[model samples]
Target: MAAPTKTLSVADQLDQLQAARKLALTTPVYYEKIVKGVLPIIGPTAPIELRRWGAEFLAESLATPVLAKNEKESLTIAVLDTIKALLESGDDDPIVLKASIGAAASAYPIVVRWIIFNSYHPDPWEQMSAIKSRVFRIWDTAPPPVKLACIKFAQRIVLAQTVSNGQEARLYPGLDVSLGMITGSHPILDPRRMEAEATGLLDRMLGVLQDNSSDALLVDGTLNCLSILIRTRPSTSNRIINCILNFNPLKLANSPMTPKTKVLVKSMEKTTRMLLIHIIKRDPNFQPGAPGSQQLGRIQQYIQRLERSKTEIFDEAGRKRALADQSSAQYGDTKRQRTETPAAVAVTIPPLGPGPHRYSALYTITNNAGLQSFDATQVPHQLATRIVVKTLSSISQGVLDFAIAGIRDRLKTFQPAPTPSFAGAPPPGAINPATAPLGVEEGDDDYEPNFNAAEDTEQILNKLDNAPPEVPLDHTEALDLGPFTLPSPPLLDPDTAIRLAQAAASRLFGPLSSLKEEGSRKPRAGINRLAASSYDRESWLTVVTRLATRSTAGLESNFKKEETGRLALNDTLREMLFVYILEDWRRRIEVAVAWLCEEWYNDQLIKLSGSGAPLNYEKYALRLIDGFLNYITPQDKVLTRFLAEIPELSRELLGKCKTLCGDPTTVNLTLTSMLYLVMMRPPVRAIALDTVAEIWQEYVDARPLAAKYLTKWRPGFIESQTIGQSSAAASA
Candidate 1:
């Protein structure tokens, strides 16, 4: 071989020259030669082919893995130097600028890492800014993944500056732009992105600390991000605090420190101390004698210890000097030797008297006609019991009695008409009053004895005599006369009442059973009949429909029919009706109670005597004293209403409740229904605590049957207690 025969084409010669020129631009050791040779090639007529070949060679060099690490670093610095020269050259060639940017991107990671690690270099901050600006410009037009990487690099630069004592702060001039890249255009930054990128960055920094154990740089960077996060997004601060708190601070304490790490630790300690102080100050439950006082005391003690520790960390010489100063200060402290006086004795008031149930009387009377007419015909016994209970529970005894009296009085007004008078013959040409007179004649002398006047006089005499009055002979004869006596109105019969009761029970319970037996052998026809018949009467059908229409769809089909029947009686129909009635009653009661409270609060008795001015002080004092009284009085009124209506409705409905299955054991069922209704009403449910306590005391004192029902449902009482305890714990 004649050593490749030296047969070079013009293109081959030009390529060799371009490769040498590119190598000179990348190597810092060849800076003088490149500046001399490449600086003069920038004129308009400069060889286009040679310049293009040089730029291509430079771009290719970035991908070479065989380059030594030191050589690669040298190449990065040289490329940056050339970029600065090109930018200052005032060359506005789009192609050249684009080529330079592409080349710089290929070597960006290597350049950034080198510059960051060697941040102590004199012009490192300036170099970082230059690099960052270049990266951002390229990133604006780059693919998403590349843009994301650029953001990551910017974060690294911020971290690097934070570690270097704020030396590179100016490097992150477009921080908001960088954040936009990471979070995209989402209104609320996606937590998933935050977790992946931001969280991972912190974890990586933490990993660096873990691996190196003495990497103050990494620790400082992590703390900077944490501090920024705490300031900008306070809700996320708790999460970061939890993360740090879970870590053993003692491990970090044992690690070697640069002065920077020690400063960071001090800053964190101060932040924690301030946070704890604020938590303690704002919490009213932290005070003594308050509900959770003991837990508050423990937390206070822990915070005090932490505060003391922080003082010790900052006050090395002051801690020792403070004890000596305290001893000297106490030497002449005569005021400290004086004993404190005890507080004046408090006047004790006697407890209040028993509530209104003691003074009130409760009774029930059956509407015999209503009972007989509807007992077994139209009403099912179970359903009738429900309706009776619902109606009775909803109204007060006073209201019920008033309603009954009104209805009876109205009935009496519809009495039979008096018999026609044909006893005397009319005078010739004298028209009969009933036949001829369309209107009553004024001043008529032939006036007959008024039968209504005689009847009123007879009733008055009968009332005064207090004896059974004799029936008149003509009245007895009129009773036998056709068309004189009216026919008896239809009374509520037992069978009809029973049918109504059963119908109600089926309507309430049947749907629940059908839902449970959807795909089973039992036909859903009976349930459908029950639902259809009682749909108008039961309110829970609406609730059931709403609940069934939720995303979870329908109720389970595996429920036992008997169980569902019982539940319908106890939970759905009775409960819903009770809640409805109670709510209506509660609203009315609250209005009355609030008015009474306002009146009592503003009463003359509550004001100071003989003062023209309003006695605001005395008025407030009386409110405190009479507040319980005001609450209880209206409460009693409401209870009285409830007791009157509930029991009567229950008794009436129960009497009517004889089902096809025969009279179901209904006393317990009725009681359960009453309890369900009372408990389900929001107002009643809200006051469950006060109500239970009041009722329990009454039960002890009066031993009423209603009290016995409350005792049977004691689990509800315990649940309220548990809730109170949990609330107390949380406040503590």
Candidate 2:
């Protein structure tokens, strides 16, 4: 055998590593050669360039196709050990840290396999924790690239640990399994170890997202990681959701921060929208919060029940004390103190229980009740598409409106593109014209205005070079809202003509529809399915009916029973409702009319079917109409004025009534409900009563109820006799 070559210098090793990048992509290098030669160059004493290139070589070497798992095992360990040395050493060289992270990521498959074999090791998390801890410790000081690599590695591991029994995850080609795969049929190790470490890793990613200094790359990686984490371990889903909500970009504006570049802003919005889509699509129950793990869910419920029980007891005690005689009040106070002392102390005393129970996300979609701040500049068309498509399905009806607003705001980014002037057309310079859009004066038609192109160009150049014009100094410029000040949105870049054109096309082309998925508890990627403007009112109506009805159809028995859950938009979609209905108001009105009619028909059919399924059609129909009214009518105000503005809505209600009142017995029931509404909504009392009087004539059975209001117009009371009797009594 030939004598082994002399050990390569660090510089030589780096040179080879750099050259090998291209080779590694096409053909894997020998793992032993990479470990012994390239890896040594990454030692602390080596130059940053040498170390970075060296670490990168180790990352590529792990994929040596000629080497099977057994052959690669020793190399994998060697590579991971080097990376651990680099990372754990707290070497702050960003290039080195970043490269080592990439190196570690490349070895993720091996790491997972090793963990699989040692699933029952006394310290299963020991290795994972060490790796994760080192990453976290260095993250703040590391560059964006390093943070991004760390995030990707965490996601890979999380996806691997995703407790799949074949159905949950698809196997890769050739190989049957990865991500905790083990021998034969039982490849997966204990999932709890992976899960715990993954959660910690997720937490680390979230920290990067929360940091103000984080760049778009870091944000993008964090979001992608979160998407996988939610899929794999849904226990902390609510916490993840809250983090997204609180990571508000709008709020980031008007604060002292490194101003974001346009690309970065767009990227952040895009990433956030993508993240939202992942979340809303997973919780198939189409509700705001995911359920905690069973044990945690039960624990939360138990605690809530106890708190409610305590409140009730205190309420009862207070009521009794108020009604009690002096003697009894004193005795009751003593008894209350004796009982309540331990209750208050119990809250202070930590419970001797196992680790905290798991629950789904805590964030809720409160329909339009909670207003979310949306910056006019940040969430342009790309972002709006996500908000509209995902949030509108079931989480929030308001998403339709919110999306419209976001889109409109984004559309403002584009100014209509100017038509390119043909050559030799007087350079398309200013011409005196009667039709100048800005109202410039017209000159004589024959007047050929002399132009100094160079002077004009100089003037234009001067304007460009000039500092921005100053504005007059103004007052305090802030509105105090107790703890906060009213904010002004950040200045936006001038609209790009191209984006406007694209948005216009997207809006006109993309009429949305929901597509159900197989076996998924949540809605599928029912993203923008744009349509032509020719999609008439009826077609749009069908879309709304299908989406809305499906949301209700998928509800759980308990969700249907909960009053607050009814027709309420999910919190994520809080700002969208008003904008949605008003967009194509005529078409939307048509759809709403058709939808209500359909609901009425369904209610009648369900009742007639007598299936005894206890369909909550009554509540549904009432809330369907109520939901529409809630959007149109301002809160803490009567529905009268707003109801009048929506004449078609009233017409639809009356038309539906006319159709239903065709049944004689139903006329009285319908009129009575109408009367009840009139009484409750004082603002709309006249419209309600007037409607009842006008429609009651169709059915004589409704005449008795009409008597209550006849004196004004329906003549239920003898007006002339009543007037004369009142006059006679006054005269006497």
Candidate 3:
């Protein structure tokens, strides 16, 4: 007999729900199902834990990018009614209020987009507006978290409803409903009214900064949202920057300066500095001579003031230093801990041109006499004119003609005989006036000729004639440039060639086997796989695919080591693939699918006695599926592509799904995947239908959903099963 089933209590049910909710966050396939279950639990009458869990889940789901915009719109329509109830519940629980506000923020744009396309649909906008009203009413008296959320919601409203000019405008038609989108009159949506509401909300945000008594937390939140608005909405940038400049972080100061207060002050100052810098960096009008340059200057000056305030007012060390300096000044003591000299003032260098007529040195010279400074003005006009005239008249006509004749003779003449050295030699220490340098006079105090130029030139010619004929570099006799005979390398068979190559590779990469050496102070010898030049996604894909699909012909001898290496390679590749997909699965879904298909096909070939060892293809495939499901949202188009391209469904894979799926929602998703296969993938339709039939017969929770599809695809299958059951009952 089968064991009796056990019933779970309320606490157990809640525990199960908590786990399911957490799991559903990562597994997007079950989002709608999870939503349906949690909507009722979040009501005011449910336990706080359940309510809190539901609210947080709703907030994160709406905010997350995992779900596309259209999907979020659909979810918003479903959650609107629940959100309305939570807002009206009058619960002071900050968690509930904060979460509801956040969900509304994420949902508002989606709801507005819906209203834009379907102008006749008044229900969504009305519900959203009602949430808006409740939030504004509670905002004034709400706690810190709730109030902050309210500020963010206001920012979103402005971003959505306040249409801007130029590229700042959203490109998508229905991304956010704006006044400019509607051309004609509408029954429900008043573009002017929505825009005005957004403007008022913006004023409220700016008011936080305007008011001197505003809470530091509120100021911080206001500044944060303003930054986002400035980035995304160019029209609002000028106004937002002006308002930020007017506000001061020091104004939010309180007495006694608790640690919390100090932190808050520091945070506010940092945020303001960052925002101002961002504005300056991105400002279109900030270039030199632009009209906005003045504004930029003011912003820079304000930042400078804030820096000074940070040091003189808030810095403990700076404050202590200032106090010590004050005491020293009163006592007239000059010694100090550290003193900084005043910075040298910058002096502008005059541009290159004629200078003033007043005497100044053209250049200074040092000589045996003394330092002598030369002035251009001191030179008489006659002397300057004579120098200019000499420079102009120095070129003579005969010089060029003589130079050309000399060159023609040099090229036409045959090689000349070597010249002999001078027969007469000067006495030791005697200077030769005939070999004197051209510029020095014969009787000058520093006059000296180190060598006779005529003799030196003759000696160079003699050395050149006696030297060996110039040998080309390639024919140097000192180095044997032989076609040197190396004993003809013993013929290397293909096996030996491959062995030598493998040995070289092993020697080079041997350090990779052990990552680190024991008791060594030297830096690590192992390679850094995460270095910038290391393998990227495409490289890893190419190498791993080649390794996966190529034949292992001669490697069959050492089956044990080969298998071990194959498994390690598979593990590394699988890990790399998972990380690559996880980083950006939306765009890379096709990559993952292709890899899985290749793995499955390769596994089949291995089963047919292919040379390479079979891998844990199914293990990694299931792991990837698990991870992919976590990121999936309801009705994801990427999931459709995945299902369409996946390999043929197998019994073992389906049986594993059956083991893992314990809930109706997960079972429903599994059935949907199979149903998609039945409709879209014609080659696998029969197999997918058979799997669905098994699911329908086994999972009582999945039968109704399964029957809907099976009835159409496999006509009369359910009805025939019912008749068979009735006949068996009647015979028994």
Candidate 4:
């Protein structure tokens, strides 16, 4: 025996111990042996071997399964008893505590199950609750990893019990004691556990309130926890707000404790104010009229009390800090207060562009229900015209009401009747019934008189003597408004005015070639007539002058040149002038036509310009001519081209006129006028056809009640062209 110990070196002894521990971990009997053997050795200053052995034994005990229900129960009790003893052992050693935490984590499920089964057993939850406080105490002194393990254990136990049974069943009667342990532990403050712990605590706290139906408990618990969390971590503020918003409102409303309800409400208000102030101070473009304004308002009201309670919350210093923080985050650097002062607020209203004005008007009309009831008649003529012109010029709401009013007025004034002058007369210098072709047989001479000339004359005289005196024919003629008078002469020469007018007119009325061949066969007589009336070079010049004057006045001060220059050479300035002139003329003409149609014409044109059936072509023609003369300016080349071509077409169709004047109501004529005017401008000419096509497509897509009208109008226009062309060819 003397040399037996010498046979094993220190390394060999350690190897033997390692082998035994592995065997204990793998085999049930060996595992129990290790637990019983190592428990007594787990104390302060224990040999390093004994410490290792104790840790290994605890790990094995947790993994080992006890047979039979009774044995499992006994094993769970033993594990809890062991944890309790270790907690009371007064060991502050980190390694020992870490080992204990790991062991306790592993045994949590078994302990929870046992406690649930023995809930009626004397102090079943109480015993575990006592251990819970110890867990927190150990966590406070332990390393971060060990602390994390403790939180993990708590989460697992809660999750396991909750999955098997609802929250009420899982949270034991003494659950508050364990919650206190968690609260004091401040697990939610741990960076690694913050999100999960916060979420769990929120759920638990809310569940407890719901089950107990006690607002006081819930409000107090939640507020206290939130206050602590907010102080430590402010980033979770948004997430908490979302949770509160999602909770059952009815439950909160029905809370038994009014005081508690008030407190909760106050807390919510405080949180809301904090969020809003942060957002407003940080966001430069934040406005009360933005999309989320309503939601933001509700939040603001919620926090109004808090704002009053803590007036300093929004003080200059706080605002400065918040701004500094925001800037720091944005630029990822420390920010300093700027030495320069902020710029002063601008007071003057800036001039608007056609695009912006039109867009603004459209947005207002489409999105704002309030504008629908505005009375067009109430608006001033100049303002209304400007609005309409600006809106039509681009697509903004800058002058929405004005534009709408202008359009309404124009629509009202549209006339359905043709001018008597155009309807009563043939083309200038054309043959009249009063001056029929010479040498034409006047009487029915081919049919022989019943008797010789003298006898026939005597018989005719006898018959005339016997016949009663002839009655005079009563004829009524429609009144004609005189040719449109231009307010002023245009700045441009007659030739230039004609060219510009033609260009403008073509933009409004597209080319005949673009129409279908069948449709092209008949040109609406009214359109031709209107074209002829508008073709008066002098009248068109007057229109151009009026338009140019209005446009020059309406332009934004910033863009206008201080000094005058040649209008033709300055392309940019010329383009601006051209746009302004067109816009001005269009608006004025629309207004004038609306007055004429609504007041003078008795709204007849609007009714006549239908989609189905033929329109009163002559009437539309007269309206167009009148509208152009009233609105067009002399410098407008586009309008001139459009008007110039109309007379030729009108002349060709006049030969086929069965009556002195053709019918004014015809879809063909209306479309022809619209198309011709659209094609007058080069830019408009390029897109006009496509625009009309798209409009038709959209009309069909919308399934509007007026779809039939559109369809019928398009075909009728074709018929008018066909009829016109046939008659023209025949006359030629």
Tens-digit lDDT string for candidate 2 (1-732)? 999889877677656776766654543444476466666657767677776666666666765567666667667766665677777664577777777777676566566666566655423235545766787676676667876777777766655654443434453442222444544344345556656766776676677666643477777778777764554445555567667655643333334434355446556655776566544555432233535333334333434454464445335546633544677775566545654334422112122234433221112222333332333346689988888787557665555565456545534444467766687555446663644644343554344544654556778888888969789755555443357677996764334433443344334324554422224343312223332223543344355443433334434334334444333322112112224444544334533344444444545555675643334334433444445432331121223322333223344454444444554445555565556556565665666666775665556666666656555434533465468769999999
- Evaluated against the true structure, the overall lDDT of model 2 is 0.53
Q: Which ten residues in a row have the lowest lDDT in candidate 1?
A: 655-664
TM-score of each: 0.18, 0.33, 0.48, 0.23
Residues 1-732 of candidate 3: C-alpha lDDT, one tens digit per residue: 999999766677679887887777767767777887778877877777767877888898888777666677788899998988888885668999899899999898788778878887789888998999999999999999999999999998998877654344445444544456654586677778877887788989898887743377888788878865766565676788788889888764656677777787788889889878876887555555655677778899999999998777676654334445565577665555467889965433222234343222222212323334445567899999998789658956665455455445543343367755575756656766777546566664565555654567888999999999975685456677668686887898655665564454334333333433234443322211222233344333444444434434235534575345433433444565566677778877766766676677667767776655656567766676667666555445665566666675556655555542346446666777777777777887887788888888887878888799899999999999999989999999
Best-performing candidate as measured by lDDT: 3
The Cα RMSD in angstroms, rounded to one decimal, for candidate 4 relative to the true structure is: 39.6
Shift of residue 592 alpha carbon in model 3, Å:
21
Q: Residue 184: error of model 1 in Å?
A: 29
Off by over 4 Å in 1: 1-13, 18-51, 87-95, 116-120, 134-732
The 10 consecutive residues of candidate 2 with the worst lDDT sum are 357-366
Report lDDT per candidate.
Answer: 0.44, 0.53, 0.70, 0.45
| All candidates: CA RMSD (Å) | 37.9, 41.8, 19.9, 39.6
